[model samples]
Target: MVAQRSPVDLTDRRALLARQPDDPTVLAEAQRLKEVALLDFGIRDSVVASWLYTKCHHHIPTTAVETAAVVATGDGSCLLLYNPQFFVDIGLAGVRFVLFHEARHLMHRHLYAEQELRADPLFHLAAEVSINHVAMVRLQVTGLPSRVVPGKDAGTSHEPVGVDPREVHQRYADDLRDQGREPLSYEEFVDTDLVVYRELKRMRTPLVMPVGLCIHADHVGRHGSEFPADAETVGLIIGEALAEAIRAALRGNRLARDEVLNLIDRSEGGGDRLTRMWGNLGAAALRGETPRTRRVDWWKRWLADTLASKLREGERLVYPKKQGAVLLALGHDPMLSRRGRERTKVVLIALDTSGSMPDEVVDWVTTLVGQTDGVESHWLSFDGVVMPFVPGERVYGGGGTNFQNVVDYAEGRLAIDGVPFEVQPDAVIMVTDGYAPHVTPAQPDRWIWLITNGGDDWPEHHHPPMACHRVTTGDR
Candidate 1:
């Protein structure tokens, strides 16, 4: 049992309207509790939850709800709404469970948004049961979280209000057995949120009443005018947090990877956007297999996304065609000139032509750079010398690979076809077998290396490391 303040004291309707906490002591206590829980999450390998909490605004609003929740702020952000007295009532352990539970709820919302499922009370209960189960296992807590009894003394009347998956499964088994139907085994029953919902819905008698108390179980007017948040805004905020978590995991954070894989597994029910985003962005790398069968390889998708980010790093201004038309209509000079000449990004692609390079790799690179809207691509094949070549044109090199020669030409120390390399490339992509000695580029940050199979990735180990990945060819 955990100690908590009595909710009976704030039962009056007028008190709910006071959005801000008047007492500094109560506010400080709540903040202290949240900080401790956050620390615990960091130490316990709950990276996604911890990261999400850090990105959100923690608000101690005087609301009628007893527990905390993650809600949107009407803007393009989210906040964790908690009650100070509720935080003080639940001990540190309980606070941790509640906070984690709320964070998981936000993730669940982002993963599943089907209207039919949202409308199903049984499905909502299933979500609560599933989330609470994960929380208990991850937090290593044997007992379910207890809610503060409204009319009782501070610590004497705590009741277990958290949903128990085993209990629900048993009830489901009994109901299905009575109707001469077979119930799924315990393992299958609690496999995932959507799976649990499907099993629960198969029961002869629907669980009309909720087994325990869950704030989300009551979907009626819960986030009314009191909380000015919409599902879409909150979903976007959580999505951004999830993306950051994935990036951290890809950067070799073991704890972060564990949490992200767990999240990706649970969000298996999301639609195409989720599938494409999760599949292409390191999920396959983390799971050791691509998420789904697709025509485009995961590494190719990764390269395209990486290139987009590097090329779109700087700012560019558009003329705003509508603005010019309006100005001309007002009898003023339209001034329809380009505002930013930096719109066209310059990119250099250097292919190592010493050995037989994969045609598929070159073709893919050509398609990506060609399809891009505003780009000026410089193609070159280098062996002992750098030779400027056009896309789809066969350029051969046989003697030996020299990375320094390519670098010299790119940095203007050497000339190709009597043309000085005047412009600074926004991005330089090097595709090679990685057999040559490594040379540092003038702007190492602007370089991306794609090493062939069984090739050295020395650039990744270089100081101030550049972007690097191993390109897998189907028929090399």
Candidate 2:
């Protein structure tokens, strides 16, 4: 029989940590165990695990933690804490499982940094389930040692630890069947973190999370106010790390390549947010597709094609007497002039500026228009009235939206700040949320409407509809 350990005193954990450094041998053992865990990560070909482990500060803090836990430092690094005595009890395989488990928690936090999602208790349980499932499969562990019991022969039974995702899924499946509903397979049940949470919520009585199982439960609060640092930047860092791992794996590292490929397969089509996040990581290898195919943002491409068609040169060409030498050399007459052929297309870009447009969308539009050659760009930031401003200039707006004012300005029917748009524009592009009154433009064909996500798409359904496309601002 295994000897039962005394209840851990949470209050004295700090005092124990304060005296931890005094024990050199215990600290050395902890370091060795960490190295062994890294080796296991290598064996499993987990690039994310290896990268995350490198960024973590391993400490054998004499805390009451039964096994191990990882905590984000809010500065793009994490702390990996373990009890040295616990390592001796559970042995090497258990230590490897715990370390991998902790690393995955950090990745989960980085990937799904939304405050609302992280706050949901069901979501937290789902994350635990997903991480544990992946760890078990990758590490080839049928079970983990129990922390509640400890002795010379403790944890040798190989019984699974904590809340098993498969068992919970099975319980959910059984309940759904009783209700005459279909249950997801074990593979589908553990697809993504949110999928698990959403499916579990459908249950009449969702599984409750047992206490003292998840170590970082307290860290995720209702508002995520605990983590004040920029979560997006941290997420970007994690993405870059994944990209490097993928590249390393591609360079003949079989283990890393297989592990990352599995992660990619499991996380495919998670949602637009996840897609955008992974897109930035140069994750072509993950998708098993080329970069060209992935860069195809439908709306952006449509907008580009529309602009190209609108600004296309007229059939008429003027021959310049002085610059016709090149044309003459090509067996063409000197009558071919470059002056009229190179017609500068006039484009007026109007922003709604109702404090509803995303800054990222604005930046993307500005960059797109600024880079095009042979186009005269005119920028207008409008709320109730139109304000003509140069590109890259900041325009503050908090007033009501008025579509008529923008149309009037673009049509040369109005002037602002002694700047009159006397020249007829070849194309007028409007970026808005479609929350204002509908006004017909003088030339609706030349007008292109790019509506932001969640905006009213009135133009799309309008009688004699205008060119319109929804800009998918994924996760921005």
Task: Pull out the clashing pairs in model 1.
Answer: 3-89, 4-89, 5-89
TM-scores of the models, in the given order?
0.63, 0.52
**Candidate 2 ranges with C-alpha deviation above 4 Å:** 1-27, 57-60, 64-66, 74-76, 110-113, 148-160, 219-237, 286-288, 291-476
lDDT of each: 0.72, 0.68
Candidate 2, residues 282-351, lDDT tens digits: the string is 3553456533334445566557656764674342122354555675688743332122355788889999
Displacement of residue 452 (Cα, Å) in model 2 is 38
Q: Write the residue-wise lDDT of candidate 1 on 348-385 in tens digits.
A: 99999988888888988999999887999999999988
Question: Measured by C-alpha RMSD in angstroms, how accurate is candidate 2?
Answer: 19.5
- Model 1 is weakest, by summed lDDT over 10 consecutive residues, at 1-10
Query: The CA-based lDDT of model 1 is what?
Result: 0.72
